[model samples]
Target: MTEQRLRALVYGDVDLNLIDGSAIWAQSMVRALRAAGCRVTLVLKAPVRTGRLVDPLTELDGVLVRHPHAEGLVDGDAPMTVPQAHAVLGRVDGDHPHDLVVVRGRAIAAALAGDGAFRNRLWPYLTDVPQNLAGFTPEIHGDLRRIARAARTLLCQTEELRCFLEQTVPEACGKSVLFPPTVVVPPELADPAPRTANTPLRLVYTGKFALRWNTFEMTGLPTRLTNAGVPAELDMVGDKIHDERDDPDFADRMRRALESAPGVHWHGGHPREKAMAIAAGADIGLSWRAPELDASLELSTKVLEFGALGLPVLLNRTPMHETLLGEDYPLFAASEDDAVDALRRAAQNPDLYALAAARCRAAADGFTLERAAERLRAALAEVYPQPSVAVAGPPLKVVVCGHDLKFFTRLLQHLAALPGLDVRVDPWRTLSEHDEERSRELAAWADVVICEWCGPNALWYARHKKARQRLIVRLHRFELESGWPQKLDIDRVDQVVCVSPHYAALTAEATGWPTEKITVVPNWVDVAQLDRPKLPGARFHLGFIGAAPSRKRLDLAVDVVEELRRRDPRFTLFVKSKLPWEYWWIWKRPEERAHYEALFRRIAASPSLAEGVVFDGYGGDVAAWLRRVGFVLSTSDDESFHLAPAEGMASGAVPVVRNWPGADTIYDRRWIHRDAGEMADAIEVIVKGGRWDEERRIGQGQVRDGYGLPRVRDAWEEIVRGR
Candidate 1:
């Protein structure tokens, strides 16, 4: 039987282009559901008038976008009435009903709650719970209770809101799911703006100037910071909307306040992308509001938006903010005076500001679109389970388990694109015996299970494998020395994959497993992603990637750089890695700690070695970084197909591999060196002998032919299918 595509219908009363909370929530939801392999149709009650117009039949990233009326609904208006919502739903759901119907606004939810057509398909996404609703009349409260009880799934933005809903309507407790708003950008684009001691502190605000937001107090922040002897500026990127019923002169009053404040630039209004761009270039984001009027038990989306742009936020000290940003976040404030002091301190102390900014960036990872999609997919899977059926050629269910997602994400992508394969990935960063239940679930769902590393995941599958399930475990260099190999039940596993024959032999001896069970499979590399032209002045530069732990022999790399700098001062060593001292586990080991400590001491004592070495911190742009590195050095004491040199070689960089236990099995013999002196001699030949370009071409050709993704995929398929 052919698989059916999952379909979802998202209904909202807000205009898609409006710069409001409802629009943001609706658009993000649509994008996330679409990314999770659902055919989504977004039905908006009003038309989009600002930015780009999303046509009624237009598709975006596989999502079918639609807006019913062009001018019937006003921008930034209240939610649509019951009759209007019914008309829109009737037009959209003509003949075939959607598998899932997600409504955003409370008014829309109330309208559809009693409709028998949407009985088990309705999912109400509540963005806000108004405090005034607690004192509602009996008739109105009954409507809310009915809506909450009738929803197939009640989605809340935060845990506090979820709890609040369960208290207000007890039946919702069982069906409620916490679904936070999300915004995701690539690392290269989301890089934080550089901060320096001399640079003026830039504070940004990007929301409506409602009186409840305490815009009046925010207008005076820049002046207050300046008076405190700190150079500061504020960039306000929104406009004040006038509501005659609430406050007739609020917009004029805000305009006058902005004019009176010095060093405050009022950038009236901007689209979402423009606003995020302005925020990304700034140093800080402001999210202050009056506590009495702030009904946000759920998190403020503005805080998350700024964090997604890599800016630390200065939000009020509320329960929601504390939960998301942590209790110890230094930028939390309760009053204008507190905010002023926080800004002053951040401006005066560069290190403090950098640390806080890093924390904010780290916090943003939890609310990424990818994570949001995972939640949605899990929820949908529970609601709509796939049917088990016999077919002519069923897709092979393959589950790839790993501790590091970075190593397996690309490989999973390759597997997912294959014709007759269904791949699922389960990544446990610090896998232990406690994760046995999760491992068992993943293993039971697979026809073939491949463990990326010979760690806890491999051991779990080895002990728990079903007779019908085919198990494969891949071992790298580190696993060969670890005690995990001896504990594995080799009888349960079908195959053990090694990157090189040398490691295959070592693994067989370590585990006492038959040699027939071991096989060599080269790691796949995306050659196209790495093949870039060399940057200017890259010929003399030497690069080392992954310098963690003491066994990497980074000191040997420095020795090679020290020798080369004697002949020519232009040669430099660029080391790309996370510093080993940052990890507590590595530093706690006495021998490992002393080895790195002494290595740093030697570098500190040598002027040439210290000056010639450049530490490039861990980053995602390896392909771009390799362009500036002419020679890639691998100075490890042992190895099982170290991929750094192969990746560098694909980028037209000459490989300089040190002779190790398995180096000969993977790399060409000519590139292998016995010691630092031999490595320096190879570098000298490449540079002084003018063989840089020739060696680069040869290395690139070798890696592309040997380790390309297509060749690796074919080999994996053959082993997995037992063909």
Candidate 2:
């Protein structure tokens, strides 16, 4: 049977006629949600006009648009009046009831706060800081609190705002989700046009020229660049002023500045598409705003739009800008002079400008329509969870229970991508540590429960699972050696998954489970994220990851580095792991503590080993770390699937696996070595004979083709489906 599509209603006090930020947001959001399989209905507070040249409703595909009217409610106001609430409620109740109702304005949020009927359906999208609400009354605050308490989710524009709301309104702590402004690039500007050396540095500003945005500096920017000996031009693609009712003289002041400034063209108020087209040809984008207003916590839609067009933005140096673009980003402007200097630098070196533009484009990916849709879908799923069982042609409900989320997060992502599967995670930090009720709830919600490790989580589900639910437990090398496997209910579990065939055989022997129940499923790796350009001196650098237990054989890694140092002094071993003493559990074992201490002492005593080894403490940036590593060394005594080598291989690094029990089964025998001497010989031959590149390519290809997310996901799908 076909499943029912989700229904969503997005309403706000936004003007559709004006081609402004709010209009762009409404259009993009409606389109994005529609694209994510949602039947969206957009309700605007203002009345629909027929006199306009283009209808906004016609532009937004698959979205039903409505304009509901109230007698006394103004466009932007707090504490919604009684008539306003009645008008909105009447419209919703008069029509088909929506599964989700997204209120964009605070007034609208207030209007619906008291309605218990819309509580579960309400999702308040607070664009700005609630603290910044103008004419903030005690009544409005009460309404906000009520709305926060009632709404299923409170959507925030930025993480800063989310954190602020969580702190200020503690009631909204676990119910907020970040829904940043997204950029939708047209096909023409999808891929950035490369800027040439001789092209004049064309800077484009495409938003309201308000005083708050520092329109005065924008007008004089072109002249400043020219004075700095850089051939530049500025294109201002927006109105001369904004909020003219409050500041009537601001437009005239801006016009006077623009008229006086040379090499500045004011093409005011074009359609968003036309403006973006103009922006697409520009070398750089400008987003210099007044810091005193302190709206830095809010993400600038202008920056994201510019990035979507693949142009590097010349933004103000603020915490928000630093968060979006890195601190070391070349185009940050503190003053008008700083902006000029940045433009001059970019104009002088086209290569530097290209690099900066590329970085901006890459950063923009996180705020694209697709990414926003994914986040929205995930958020909605949590609010309105799918049922565990279907009425007919049952869809699979998979519950992934795990102790460590490091490996299982990737697997969960893959499982979520599969068709006809409703997957959820039940993570416990340790075997014994878990919410018993939550674990049982998750187990009850599943057709198949997969325990990531054969630990307490596995046993917990085995004892608590429903009669109809199938249980599958995975056993890594360490789990087989541990006593937990013996305690597991072998009769309750339908199958056992192992990382490799060797581990599968060993697990069956250890647990005395039927051989027919054991199967192999390799670990999934994100090949796309790992496939990055290797650093310049990476070829000579050997890397070791995860040196926690004494069994990892850090001493063996030292021996390999020492042997490599004899051939070439440039060879260095970069250990990307935590020191043994850093883990409190490792220090509890006297023998393990003594072994690690003795190894550290030996390294300190030996000048060659100490000089050759560089210990980079535990880091979350494995992709960045792997770029500096040319060879990934797995010197473990035993591993079901040592992911470090596979990750390294995906990052264009060759794998040098020490022949543990399951190492040969997971990795190619050509890369696996019998001992430290053979490992050194293999490294020497590969590096000296120029076979490193070939080996790197082969290893990377193997990982991408074999252990990639798609292949691993397919394997899990097949096993769960009883194929």
lDDT of each: 0.78, 0.78
lDDT of 1 by residue, 617-704 (tens): 6765576678779999999987678899999999899999999888888899989999999999999988899999999999988998
Model 1 is weakest, by summed lDDT over 10 consecutive residues, at 383-392
Q: Where is model 2 more than 4 Å wrong at Cα?
A: 1-26, 29-38, 41-58, 65-204, 208-218, 221-234, 240-255, 274-471, 482-493, 508-514, 528-543, 559-578, 582-585, 602-631, 650-654, 674-698
User: TM-score of every model?
Assistant: 0.52, 0.63
**Candidate 2 structure quality by residue, lDDT tens digits, 1-723:** 014777888766566555567767777778778877788887654554421313544566677765454333345434335456446655665567887888777767767777777876788888644545453467766776787888978888876676556545656655677788888887887876678667667989887778778877788877777778787888888652665676788878888776667878878677677889899988899987766645555777888889878899887877666666777899987777787888889889877788778778888889988888897887765544443323236578988888786666655655664447778888787888998888878877889998988898888898987899899888877777779999988889999988888878888777788998898889987675467557667889999999979889988998899888988888999998888888899989999989988988988998888898999857555665677799999998887788999999998999999988877778888889988889988988988899988999999999999898657866776777666
Best by TM-score: 2
For each candidate in turn, give its C-alpha RMSD to the true structure in angstroms.
15.8, 8.8
Scanning candidate 2 in windows of ten residues, the lowest lDDT window is: 48-57
lDDT of 1: 0.78
Would you list the clashing residue pairs of candidate 2? none
